[model samples]
Target: EPEVTQTPSHQVTQMGQEVILRCVPISNHLYFYWYRQILGQKVEFLVSFYNNEISEKSEIFDDQFSVERPDGSNFTLKIRSTKLEDSAMYFCASTNTRDRDTFGSGTRLTVV
Candidate 1:
């Protein structure tokens, strides 16, 4: 099965540095989402974008985070000002609908 894949599986960043996590979502899917898990915390939705515009976004997607679909297969999340609290597992997911979705292996962000 074709699944989403994220690069660097893990990343360590310094506070206030910029980080861009890459993802290749499933082809033929229309919806893309960014979700995060802060250590053992519950999965939190950050944002959802489709058709070249943001569809939905949670409060967690603040001024520091932005997402872009630079190509047909690539989706990227950029954090402009990483904070110590930003350390978490960032997962990229895609869905044709709520019933069908795939999640990437995830990039573990570590702020030091």
Candidate 2:
């Protein structure tokens, strides 16, 4: 089965640097999203993008987070300024419909 792939399963950065986490979403899907889970916290939606624009974004998706589909297959999330609070597992997901979403294993970001 095809799946979403994310690189650098784990990253440790200083508190204010920019970081770009990469993902390759499943082919033939129409919607894409970014979700994050702080340690021991529930998964929370960050943003969703489709048809080259944002469909929805949670409050957590402040100015710090941005999503882009740089090409047909690659989806990326860039954090403009990292913070200690940003330490979490960032998951990339896609769905043909809202009910069929699939998530990547996730990239763990740790800001020290």
Candidate 3:
């Protein structure tokens, strides 16, 4: 079986600092997305990427955030400046169709 992988399982950053979360999707999947979950909240969709461009994004993906598939294999999310509210478990996911998505373990971002 294939799965998504994320690095630095945990991260801590000072308020206003920058952070980059990395993920590698399953080789055969096409749709890729970034989602997050606040400690006590439900998972929220942040952005979706396909064909090397952003296919969709939610209100949470504001100007301060950006995502890139710098190389064909790795997808990255860069938060230009961190805030207390940005602290959450960020998950990376991918799927070949709309039926289901495989999610990464998650990169827990903590803003202090």
Residues 63-83, candidate 3, lDDT per residue (tens digit)? 999999998999999998899
Judging by TM-score, tell me the better candidate of 1 and 3: 3
What's the lDDT for all of these models?
0.93, 0.93, 0.95
lDDT of 2 at 77: 96
Global local distance difference test of model 3:
0.95
Candidate 3 segments exceeding 4 Å error: none
| Clash list (residue pairs), candidate 1 | none
RMSD of each: 0.8, 0.7, 0.6
TM-score of 1: 0.96
- Candidate 2: misplaced stretches above 4 Å? none
lDDT of 2 by residue, 23-103 (tens): 998898889999999999999999999998999999999999898998888999999889999999999999887778889
For this target, which candidate reaches the highest TM-score against the unseen true structure?
Answer: 3
Number of backbone collisions per candidate, in order? 0, 0, 0
lDDT by residue (1-112, candidate 1, tens digit) is 9899999799999999999999998988889999999999999999998887789999989899999998778999999989999999999999887676899999999999
